[model samples]
Target chain A: MSVDLEKLLRPVDTPLPPYPPKVITLADGSKMVVRQIGRDDIPDLLPHVEALIHHERDYYDIVSVRVYAELLAYYRYRVVDEYVLIGQINGELSAIVNGRIYSPEIGMSYHTLGLKRGLRIGAHCFAAKMEYHIDVLKQEEVLIVAESPIGFRRWMIEYNLEKKFEIPHELGGSPSYSLTREIFNRARGSLIVGSRPVPQDLLDEAMEKILPPSDPPKAPPDFLAATRAKYDSTGTSIIADPKRKKVSHA
Target chain B: MREVYIVGIGITSFGRLEYPLVEIASYPSVVALQDAGLDTVDHLFVANMGGGRINHQTALSSAVLDHLSLWPAGSETIENGPASGSSAVKLGFQAIASGMCETVLVAGAERMSEVNQLDATDFVATLTHPMAEQIYGITLPALAGMFTRLYMEKYGVTRRHLAMVAVKNHGNAMDNFFAHVHTRVTLEGILDDRDAETNNPVIADPLHFFDMCPVSDGGAAVVLASKEVAKKLGKPMIRIAGVGQATDTHAVHERPDPTELTAVRLAAKRAFEMAKIEPKDVNVAELHDAFTILEIAESEEVGFFKKGEGHLALERGETQLTGKIPINPSGGLKAKGHPVGATGVAQVHEIVLQLRGQAEKRQVKDPKIGFTCNFGGFGNNVVCTVIKKEE
Candidate 1:
């Protein structure tokens, strides 16, 4: 536990340019602010991410667990050159995206976790992360991988990212895909979008505090409804719960 | 023919259900039977589209009948693409009217979520002319895109009009508990905003993401009985006053005018004629809106509005829940979630709900007569039905 041993254990962090804040209007006319968060802010976002570690649908469980670890590592100085960006709508956490600088010319995308569903919150935050690497930091390309099919469709197919199969990504050692500057430029106008210098009020609200998601994804009333239905054949498992009536927006 | 009344109805939540196809179909039948206070029906008709292809199951009616413990009751499976639900209902009507059965249970179910979106789209695309359309990679959306371009050029339907249909339906769906998409979207966000392009991305040119219906998994059932049987049941009688079906050229390009949904027109005309009521007399309607454009187009074709003026009526708010015609109070397929086979039956279920004054939040104003247009295969096949409540 000597100071020299502690110094040897912690990786040296690189100084990267800060990501400028931007605002995007979602499908429901809510404004979302995408801004980079320092390690100090990681605590406020951890509980929300941990809550989704057992979400059990749409690959949210795996993605949230990994993102939780990544955020924790960045907070504890366990990861090198990592930066976390969060999206907040009405000061509530809607999405989280994180990545790190791999080299002077390359970037590594860790994960994009959308706490809110159906409004493309994840997509906007993801574009901001890419913009951070290519537009701000001036990286040539970013290495990315998707843990969910929805992520794959949004990033790999939507951007037409090139394969970097030889390089295993840090998450799961999956084969990586490279989103070059050319690809980002091609998708800028249509896919990647946001207005820079976010409105003062919106930016201030986002920076105020990370509120709990008003309508987070919920575990089903019965986790094993399908399996139970298979065995019971009475179709009782599919019955509607008397208490839980409405599905909240994602 | 005799009078055939829909004595009881039930439907599953139209979304990504996590049960077997038989259970999906049978659950509604059980509910319908309970609603009718009947232990059995003389026959069961199951309507399903993708059972064999997606679920790897065949003889769906047999399985559903056995699952529901309606043993020895004659059962049959019906498939007519998206029109399968109404087709099965039409056959049930025929059986009751022809005195072949005292009562008939018709249930339509589709578990399209068993496969991914691409595979489900491909399976639905198989309804197209295989040699001409399917071979050329023609999905329903692709055909709809081409048709939309022609409709836009010919009738001046714009993207704004399409978005209006989506907005109206989604708003209507907010009140429908069974609707797949409960998310409320605004014109400012989906159309006019700087991020509208990404918020409502184009699935097909002239047709954005909101313009198309979500693929769903669900079931719906209606118990059709003879007038005598219906009277004995002591439930509100919603008679299937008319049923008409028509088919057009299999290949969309083969039609003389790709913009015209001639089958919808013909089928609706015949249904209205048989119902002894003009389109104006119908209190409410559930038009097929697999795509938002179809709502506008089918509205005109079904005689709710003049051709080329549907959008104008839409502009005037004529098809809203409180408007002149009040279309798709259950959000149609656009927001209700189209489980292909379940769509037609679900349409009937909605109409029945409206006629019985059971639709709570999204109910129309004292609807006495309700109509449904169940479109199949890019308007190649269509089934139209009219239902009226007996006073």
Candidate 2:
């Protein structure tokens, strides 16, 4: 069967928090710029999906770009209260974390996508999703699933998510675990989440316990470049706005 | 370190094996033990990098060891990408040197033919930096193509020079019964036969299918023993005079010079120094020739020729069977076939045969000193070993 090249190449847009939301400064001196997915952000999220599908083909049979485009379109117009978060360093889209509050009781199903180099930026995306799910969605519980043991386990331990139960072998073979609000809060005992707000401390402690000691942390070059580009663009947008210019002139 | 010698070496026909991966591995491991005249062994080190990816069989060492009924002898699997065979050799050497075991058996096997071409390419590319290179659609052949292009531009080496390495290896392979592609090709056959139906088409730019080694299924093994044990069990011996290994940066872009393999240089230097000999002392060399240009580049890196003069050496037939130094007397990987992990030990197996004067049709006469270089990934890690015929 002939493959549809465009369908294979199209990108998927991830869900994010509402734009211009209150920003939180992570303990590691990094700021979490949480915002909702937008039509304009489609271009920014496109390259990541393209790269992810291309890179992860060995692990998963990638869907067509048309499918991805359709998903993005569906998320934009049809999915209410669901959005994509583009995690940025400076202002670049280093990673994309998307999810929706499918139900107030059931919480959200979210996925994080980025280059391995952008893992740190992806962390912000994860934290943003967690914050949005916990505070914005205000759900009683939030659950996260990851294929890799290291990533999944780290998320569980970092966010105090409980290792509920592993999915059966028939479902993708890779294990899946969940965490509830009670378990998450218990794991974060005595350490106030909102008061401390040190993302680095949490990341470092989690990495030390979860990741192999010999393995060095990576900051993907492409992720940095994308984040820098986004930051530059955001700066330019603010400077060029007619309303902002008028205020400045006054 | 204690003195070590390869008392026995075993190699299956280096062409495609129709059997399963375990069967392919079993053949040589059994043969090596038989050749060494040992019914039992203390330790087993199996070298296979692709079995898991190709056949979805992880824990190959235990599988092979269990198949051979050599269970509970501290069997371990070693994987260092393509150079896995040599890495196993290193491990066996260390075991004997550390006085942990008096005798050790190391076997390397791979079955790449089972998978489709695209999947095989993806599997090999997994050895590269996942995010930087593989994600960017860079295949191993692409890297070889780039290296060939850069080497050609820098040294004024022509495609004909690269083709010469293929031609000579194929000619040499005509005598190597174990070689996969034995059909000899003329320079015209390479350059003019661009018709996709007739000729081996170029897989990557500047690299024809013929210029590349085949994705083969084969296995090879060698029995290592301490000098004391070797003397006692002596059938015929090839002393492991020296061994060297070195690693460079993982990413290609991080390398200082793409054309140069510093890992090879350092490994060879250490090997030669430990052997107390220079490159000229080596009578035969089975350097890693996964790609044709690799043979030329590795030759220069090992100090066989000046940086830019490797192509000239190949042009002059200096590396031919009857030339000053015969390279890949068992047709090398280019002709013999590269089963990834099996390649390095296969090289040693060929060298042992040459050193023992048992390489029937392709023997390097009066071969005294021999060498083998095993490269892992894209020159990221390398191991070089020097073997001398026992007087």
The TM-scores of chain A alone, one per candidate, are 0.89, 0.52
For each candidate, what's the DockQ? 0.30, 0.01
> How well does candidate 2 reproduce the true complex, by DockQ?
0.01
Among these predictions, the greatest DockQ belongs to 1
Per-residue lDDT tens digits of candidate 2, residues B1-391? Answer: 8888898787777765656677667667766776676654678888998877778888888887776666567788899999999999989988988888888889999888788657788888889998889889988999999888888889888878877888788878889877776566666555533222123445787887767887787899998888777776756768888899999988988987888899999999998999899999999999999999999999999989988898899888899989888888888888889999898899899999999999988888899999999999999999999999888
lDDT of candidate 1 over A1-250, digit per residue (tens): 6988878878999888899998998888888999999999999999999999988888999999999999999998999999999999999999999999999999999999988877888988999999999999999999999988899999999899999999999888999999999999999879888897888999889898999999787653432244246566655433333442222111
lDDT scores for all predictions? 0.89, 0.70
Q: Candidate 1: which stretches are off by over 4 Å?
A: A1-6, A220-231, A234-250
lDDT of 2 by residue, A180-248 (tens): 656545533222122232355443433232221121222212211211245452112222334421210
Q: Could you tell me every candidate's TM-score relative to the true structure?
A: 0.95, 0.61
Q: Pick the candidate with the highest lDDT.
A: 1
Candidate 1 lDDT at A137 equals: 93
* Model 2 interface CAPRI class: incorrect
Model 1: per-residue lDDT, tens digit, B28-143? 88777767767778899999999999999899999988777677789999999999998999999999889899889999999998988999999999999999989988899988
